[model samples]
Target chain A: MRHTISVLVENKFGVLSRISGLFSGRGYNIESLSVGETIDPAVSIMTIVTTGEDLVIEQITKQLNKLIDVIKVVDFLEIDHVEREMILVKVAPRKEDKPEVLQLAEIFRGRIVDSGQTTYTIEITGEEKKISAFIDLIKPFGIKEFVRTGKVALAREGTRKGK
Target chain B: MKISGAEILVECLKKEGVKHIFGYPGGVVLNIFDVLYDEKDLQLILTRHEQGAIHAADGYARASGKVGVAIVTSGPGATNTVTGIATASMDSIPLVVFSGQVPTLLIGNDAFQEADIVGITRPCTKHNYLVKDIKDLAQTVREAFYIASTGRPGPVLIDLPKDVTAGMSDFVWPQEVKIRSYNPTYHGNKYMINQAAQMIAHSKKPVIMAGGGVILSGASKELRELAEFAKIPVTMTLMGLGGFPGTHKLSMGMLGMHGTYYANTAVQNSDLLMGIGVRFDDRVTGKTEAFASHAKIMQIDIDPTSIKKNVRVDLPVVGDVKNVLRDLLKTLKEIKEQQWGAVRSAWLKQVERWKEERPLTYRFDKNIIKPEFVVEKIYEVTKGEAIICTEVGQNQMWSAQFFKYDHPRRFLSSGGLGTMGYGFPAAIGAQLACPDKIVIDIAGDGSIQMNIQELATAVINKLPVKVAILNNGYLGMVRQWQELFFKERYSHTHLESGNPDFVKVAEAYGAVGLRATKPEEVEPVLKEALKVKNRPVFMDFVVDWKEKVFPMVPAGAAIDQMIFDEEKEEKKLKAVK
Candidate 1:
């Protein structure tokens, strides 16, 4: 099963490397990871997408908590949570297919973040399935470049019981 | 007062109550060594190799229950300590290692003697730091010590750049360390403790499997009390050898791949197995599905990650071993009547029968010396009072099986990493930690030579550490495996042609040298070596190379399925008994 885990850690040097090193060292597969400073500048929140069995996921969370820099780890699987992933896709389309691409992007609620003479860089943000659907619809027009901002997650306020 | 970073480091050490530092000086660490030159309180014992220095520090920590300190230069010097650090980390020994780095400017520029030590040690260390600024030096040292010594203790490394040491800063000792992200739970949950106590109360054939955590937590007293009060027979992992009195009737000696037959049987047939301070290492739990299959497993550990990492744990109480054990005992006492009286007695009797039937024994040869005999002699001569360290392989197994460790920290070895050269330097450190106690290293011929240069360190310091080399002329453990499973090919395990005369080597280093070539001579050599009071003594005992440790559980096999030594299986179990 895939788990989206949010870890709050001390915003210090090498904290990212430490977390990544931990995952690699323990042979845990990390599908994607993204980090950014939280409201408190001294702390940072990292979202990691990893797949493992229930036992492995438990170990992963426990191990993360063991690190000195890590403050908290919340796995979205246990409680009500929301997750989003953003992807930017640059598509090169024939002049005749431009209208169809624009219509598909509008239908999926995507925006054109950048434009080139023959390319349209569309930005899409949603759950994994929505992003995948947008990419599939845009693949008809050659995708020149692509990038994704992994997944970011947060637990629902009322559903979070205890640390 | 304004002082150099090196000076601040020294002050931090002084404040931390560190008296001895096991280290080797090199290029970048010279500033720190310079500070130690005129220092009066802290003594720096220079070792020949960085690995030796780190292992010595580890031994000191294990013996003293304090954070062991080691310092080395960057690049090769820092890299050499990796094995030692990993050894400590795996066994949860508390150690703080300082490795000097190239100047901060040269850190990632690939300058001379520069290495990203913090990055290299990240996976192995409990925590590590790279002091990029002088202002962080003292605080980093304080944090390093704090992290290394607290809950589920392990080695922590502080990589100090040369420029940081040379940089000037005002030194202020931190009175207390508070890391927002790190707070260890000291007390077990009341409900979980109650559940565990109930399980113990209801258990019929209960066995307590203790590990290094017991010793690390200083919980031996509480563990013994719990076992005795509950009438639970105890089996110890290799690292847990001394956590309980080895001579006690309820004690089932070291359990694992080379564990005693009765320990394995009791664990398999157990109705309840309470794992106190143990991680249920793979060696201890061969074929996890079959291990303690009949029992409801309960694990008490300080590290939450260790509880269910391997086997299925029915009840887990995450807290300090000492604290949890005390709570469990208190809760057990609250019960109105104990229903385990007759059932527990019968269980113990059955375990006793298994012990008597298949005791740990090696065939006694009157003419040819057996390595096991050498360990027995060391145990007898020391009267079980010496601090015993061991090199990896057959010598270590024999030492664990024959010698009785009656107290925590009495027996120290590389249980997790199984480093070959660990014992000699560790013995040196153990001797320094417990200056009045006799410290001995039961080593193999293959392993003692790995760090034999430390003989000079011992001779210079006047540490009378005895090194008993079980000279089997082969890497006996590897040879045994090859013989049993690999068709007796004996590929590269033999060490006869390249081996040095250890006695001569000892003499060259200004230490006493003794040799025993026959079975009758073993005790005499050991006795003579024990008489040496001013320098280390190397006692080389030529033993039967063909002897193998048994009853052995082959890899992936259930613990109950053991292959005993053909020569000793049916014999009367009178040898080590």
Candidate 2:
């Protein structure tokens, strides 16, 4: 099972390496990780996706909480949460397939971030499943290159148990 | 007041009440050493190597219950402390190591003598800091000590850049350091304590398993009280040797691989197990699924990760062992009379039968010295009052089995990492920590040579630390494995051809050296070594080469399925071979 964990940490240097090093050291692989400053400039939030058994995931969360710089660790597994991943896909489409590609991007609510004589860069932000579906539809048009900002998640208000 | 970063560091150490620092000076740490030259309060002892310095600091921490401090320069000096740092980290020993780094400007330029020590030590250290500015020096030092000594205590490293030490700033020390994210729960949960207490009171066949945390938290008294009140037998891990009285009737000695047969059998047959401050490492658990298979286990530890890490538990209490034990004991006090003599009589009798049937024993030889006999002789001569440290391998196992550790912190060894060269310098640190007490390092022939250079440090400091070298002419533990599991192919395990004379080596460093090649000479050699109170002594005991630690559980086997000595289970040994 994959768990999307949100960790709030002190916005200090080497915090990323400390976290990443911890994951690697424990033989836990990060499927996706994204970090950015939160509302408080001194704090940063990291959303990490990792796969493990329930027992291992519990250990992972506990170990994450053990690091001094880490402020909070929340596994979005049980809470009602919102997750989004953004990907910029550059595609080279033949003239006949250009209409189909534009229609597919429109259906996915993607915007053409950039355009070239031979390629189009479309930006899409959505749940992982939606992004994967969009990429699958766009694959027929010949993807030239792509970059993704891994998943970032936030728990919905009042969804947490007992609150 | 304004002061240089080096002076601020010194002031911080003084504030922390540090009496001695085990360190090795190098190019990058010259500024700090120069500042210390005129310092009056803090004494700096230069060791032969960085590894020795760190291990000595670890031993001091284990003995004194204070955060051990070590300082070394960058590159090779910093790298050399890796093994020692890992050893301390694995054992949950509190240590703060200061490694000198190149100037901040050259940190990433790969300058001469520069190493990214903070990055290198990230996976091992509980936390680390690379001080980029002088302003953060004092605060960083304070936080490093705080983090190193709190919660599940472990080693913390502060990489000090040369320029940072030279930079000047206000020497303001933080009165208190607090990390919002780092609060440790000293008290266990109320409901969990109640549940645990209820289970303990109702259990008829309960066994208490203690580990290093009991010793670390100084909870041995509480542990003993609980065991006695509940009529529970106690079994200790290697690190937990001194957490309970080894000679107590209820004490089942150590459990798991190389553990006493009675202790392992008790655990396997147990109906309830209260694991206090234990992590259930594989060496203790054998096959996790089969370990304590018939028992309901309740694990208590300060580190939450340690709970259910290797084996699932029926109840988990995450808190300091001392605090949790206090609560559990209080809760149990509510139960009237609290004595289990009648309820647990049958179980205790069965355990006693096992102990009598297969007590820990090694065959005696009149012509040649046996390592176990040597350990026994040392115990008798010292009257079990000396603090014992050990190098890894057969010597360590023998020491654990024979020498009874009756108090917490009396036995300090590399239990977690099992580092080979840890004992000698560790003994030096333990001796320095308690000047009036005796310290001994039970060492193997192969392990003593690892940090043998520390003899000079011991001699220079006039620490009367004793080193008992069990010279078995081979890496006895590995040889035993090869002999039993791999068809007796000695391969490279033999060391007799290149072995140096340890007595001469000790004498060369101005320390007393004695060699006992015969069984009858062991007692005299130990007594002669004990008479030297001003200088370190090394007693090289030439022992039987083929003797192996018994009650051995092969890797992946159940704890109860153990192979004993040839005299007791010759058929089992032959079957495994």
Candidate 3:
């Protein structure tokens, strides 16, 4: 099973390495990780996606919470939550396929962030499943370069449990 | 109060109530060392190696229940602390390690003696910092100590750059350090505590598995009370050796790989297992699938993750060990008339039979001194009063099996990392914690050589820490493996030809050296070593090199399916050869 864990930690030096190092030490690999300062500037939020069994995921969350710098760990699966992911994809469309690509972008509610003679960089921000579906459609147009921000989530009512 | 970062660092250490620091100086830490030259209240003990300093600090923390402090230089100096940091983290020993880094401006550049100490130590340390600004130095130091010593205590690193130490800053001591996201649950769920009490009140076969957390939380008394009141047998992990009285009749002795047969059986047959402060490590649980199969386990620990990390439990009580035990005792008060001890008589009788049927034993042929015999004699000589530390491998097992601990914090070993050279330096650190108490390092020839240079540190400090070397002439544990599993292909396990005379080496380091080659010499050597005060003594005992530890559980085997003798295996190997 894949678990998306939102880890809020003190925005101190080497904290990212600490979080990532913990995973590596435990022999767990992070599928995707996106880090940025949270609403509290003193703290940083790390949205990490990792695949593991129920037990392994539990250990990961518990160990993350054990870290002194870490403020809170929220697993999206535990409660009603909203998950969002963003991706910027540069698609090299053939002259004939350009119209199809634009129509697909419009259908997905994506924007053309950049445009060149042969490539159009499209940006999409939505739920994780929607972005994945959008990428599947864009891949047919020949994706030249693509990158994504891993899923970040918030509980529906900011409810806390098992603290 | 304006002061340099170096001065602020020293001041913060003083404010943290640090009386002693175990460290070594280097180029990157010159500024800090320069400031230390004038500090009168703080005592600095220079160790031969950075690893030794860290181990010593670890030992100090384990013994005194205070956060140990270690300071090392940058690059190689910081690199050397990696093993010690891991060892401390695994054991949950509180430690604050200060590593000197290159100036902030040249941190990423390949400057002279510069290393990313914070990056290197990130995983091993509970938390780490690479302070670039002088203003953050004071608060960082305070936070380092606070985080290291609190909750599930572990090592924390603070990387100090040379320029930051030289820079000026206002030295303001933070009155209280707080982390918004870090709050430890001190009380276990009350409903669960009552349920556990009710379960224990009815359990026909009950057991208590205690670990180092009992010692860390100073809950040994509470644990003993709970076990006695509930009439449950007690077993311990390697790190939990002294958490309960090994000499007590209800004590099942150490459990798991090198554990007593009776202890393992009791756990397998247990109806209710109240695990106090133990992580249920692989060594203790053996095959987790088959471990305590009949028991409805209730795990009590401060670290929530430890509860189900290795094995699942029926009930989970998350809190500090002392607090949980105290609450448990109170919950059990209502069932005082039940007399749980009277109900579990039959189970206790069964355990006693198991203890008598297959006790830990060794035969002394008199032709050669057995390693187990040496440990047995050391125990007799010490009267179980000494704080015993051990280097990893066979000697460690022998000590755990032969020398019983009847008090808390009396037995120390690198349970998690199993660092080979941990014992000697750790002994010195333990000695420093209890100046009037006798401290000894039970060692093997192979592991002792790992940090033999610490003899200089021990001698100069005049710590009467004794080192009892079980000189088996081979990496006995590895040799045993090759003989049993690989048809006696010794490989590089033999250290006979290249080995130096241990006594002579000890003498060279300005320490008292003694050798006991015969079985009768064991008692005399131990007595003489004990007599020498303010001077460390190294006693080397030449034991049967081929003698292997018994009651061994083969790799990947269930704990219950242990091989009790070596003769059968050796005979089988001979047929193959």
Calculate the i-RMS of every candidate, to one decimal place: 0.5, 0.7, 1.3
Estimated TM-score for each candidate: 0.98, 0.98, 0.96
Go through the candidates in order and give the clash count of each: 0, 0, 1
State candidate 3's TM-score. 0.96
Checking candidate 2 for backbone clashes, the offending pairs are none
| Candidate 2 to truth, TM | 0.98
CA displacement after TM-score superposition, residue A91 of candidate 3 (Å):
2.9
List where candidate 3 sits over 4 angstroms from the true fold.
Answer: A157-163, B566-577
Position B302, candidate 3: lDDT:
93
lDDT of 3 by residue, A1-163 (tens): 8888998898986678778888998999999999999787998999999999998999999989887778889887767778888899999999999999999999988999999989999989999789989988888889999998888887887665543
lDDT (Cα, tens digit) per residue for candidate 1, span B84-142: 99999998989999999999888799988888889999988999999999998888999
Q: Give the distance in Å from residue B221's predicted Cα in candidate 3 to where it truly belongs.
A: 0.3
DockQ of each: 0.93, 0.87, 0.78
Model 3 reproduces what portion of true contacts? 0.96
